[model samples]
Target: MAGLISKVFKAKWLLLGIALVLLLVWILRPFLDVFVYGIFVYYITRPIKQWLSRYIKNEGILVSVSLLMLALPLIILIAYTLLVGMSQLMAVVNSYGLTAALPSGPLTNMTTSFSQLHSNLTSGNFTLESVTDITRQDWYKTISGYSGNLPLLQAIAFSTGSTIVDIAFKLFIIFLVGFYMLKEDAHMQRWFAGTFPKLMDEHNRLLPRYASAVDADLQKLFFGNLLSIVFFAIIAAVVFEGLSIFAPVPSLQIPSPILLGILCGVSALIPIVGMWLVAGPLFLYLLISSLIAGTLFTHFGYFLFMVLAIFVFVLTIPSFVIQPFMARGQVHSGLLMFAYVLGPLVFGISGLFLGAIVLVLVTHYFGIVVPEMAAEGQESHDFDL
Candidate 1:
């Protein structure tokens, strides 16, 4: 009776534990993005934090300097660079006189509507009422203008917690998660290893090897991203410097090519940034200038630049080729590129990092664990033979 009761009690507790985990998951479903990003931040900064421990005496100061002091400025610089690059692209398009050449059609109406909205936003006279009123009018005009085209516009989708306060709160949570993770990095590692002691037993040591392999690959994946950015910076410098040699005008010659190259390379890693950046904007301006001066065909530089820019940025070498090369083949370049590309398409923005993560674990298992297991099997077979 006693043994039966013990078994029943154990089963009851197991069910209760499962229930609690489900409850927690439901509660955290909405804020999953915050936790995911926080974890990503922790992993990316882990190596630098470890390196800083030799010099910094205090844990608090080390974490702050590594994250807030250093990473913050880099983030801001990337953001600023992306904005500047976009503005230059817009300038190039405008210089083509596209707006002036446009007919008064649906596209023209949409452009005018957006222009008016921008003016209102920047005019400092924007109010809730004024903005809503403008939106309503513009919506009506846009709908009417496109009424004959398609009834494809059915619904507008929106996310919850889109207000400023909600955004700030989410950021705060992300920072809190990151801070604690960094502060307790050693503790977490110990906990992780201790959590599955059976797997770490002396006979096989499977868990230890698995964990070590996973950690090593993750470091390679994250640091590989950084190294790729540096590599891209070097390429950007070479390409821009070469382009400068044949430039007849200052506008065509990129100013501060080195700084701009670094910015472009870094910005490419950011999810929302589609920054061909230094090369894209420069090549655009050069093409337009060359065409306006009727030197596009005569100027060999223009043709060469077109080919170079198209080859480097448009042909998809950075994410596909350089990334895997820098990663040292722990992860395939094509697989990583697809993970970055399709993750967002299939699972939304958070999927970008999440996909890389899943790819890492899957690759580690097949690439490292399976091979090791096979090698051990071969050794045993040879010994028996």
Candidate 2:
């Protein structure tokens, strides 16, 4: 009877623990959204905080100033870069006699290529005459359709307003979370450790070790790789802009150096030839624009640029692949699985950074908590030795 009662009591506690976890998840769902975004901002800004703490004579003042200096430029640059891209797109559209000329540039060029492939698959091959006829028909239909839907201006206004509101809310949450995370990061780590001391055994210590390894991996991967990418992107954009100015192609659209720089920089964060993801579209844009302008024969400069782009990509192959893996190896002994998680299911681009951190924390806790718990139960038997 005593043994039977103990088994029943253990089962009850197990069920109760599960129930409490479910309840907590339910309660925290709303706040978790904000916290998730907060975590991204925190990770990105953590290095800045560290730099301030290390170099600046005044810690608090330096952190405050660093944040202001960091934030102001980021906000302005993102806004201005996006604005220029939009402006260029709109100008390209307007330049074509089509009233709303569909802008096809380095970015949209990829979409156009995919669409053309889709058309080829669906619509079959066409002779030159048929192609010309189809193009004319499509152009006519597009213009007429757009004219008929001119009242979409109101819809555009509504959509723009909603987008602005949403962006404002997201930015507000990010900064709010970032500030607190930076301010109380040390306290938070302490809090994380303190809650489980009684529950921890030898095995439980493994959890903290694993978590620390994961955190260290992420800090190096996200920050170091990000800086490297940004530096390379600036170099690429300067090279591309210079190429375009002198390239023999009658290129009407010059890629904004800053915009391309930022785009390439961001793309560099993604693993394995992501810079090519940016470059491929850029080259396609040049190709299409060259075709439309009827200067394909004279565009020797673009050929040279195309060659240069390929060379740069080849040169950076080591940096993009081998370097990050080497960096990761130093921090995480078993993180190959963690690196693969980002490419498939990005919550957003930031998911790469956030997902790695969460996985680390979970594994850390499991490794530490489980081993410690097992060791506790083993103590009686082992003590007999």
Candidate 1 is scored at a TM of 0.57
Candidate 2, pairs of clashing residues: 201-372, 203-371, 203-372, 204-368, 204-369, 204-372, 207-364, 207-367, 207-368
Q: Which ranges of candidate 2 are over 4 A from the true structure? A: 1-24, 27-33, 55-60, 71-166, 230-326, 330-346, 349-352, 355-385
- Cα TM-score of candidate 2: 0.53
Predicted candidate 2 versus true structure: per-residue lDDT over 1-385, tens digit per residue: 9999989787997889899999999987745545665665565567787777777777566656656766546544533443344344344444565533453332233223333333334353334565555677776764574453334433433433334667677677767777777787789888877876753433546656666666775566555553454455556656666766666655634465545655565565556765677677777887778777887657656666565764565336535554453344243423533442332123423344455566656655565556666778799679987
Q: How many residue pairs clash in each candidate?
A: 0, 9
All candidates: TM-score: 0.57, 0.53
For candidate 1, the per-residue lDDT at 157 reads 11
| CA shift of 300, model 1, Å | 6.0
- The candidate scoring highest on TM-score is 1
How much lDDT does each candidate structure score? Answer: 0.61, 0.55
Q: What is the C-alpha RMSD of each candidate to the true structure, in Å?
A: 11.0, 11.9
244 Cα displacement, candidate 1 (Å): 13
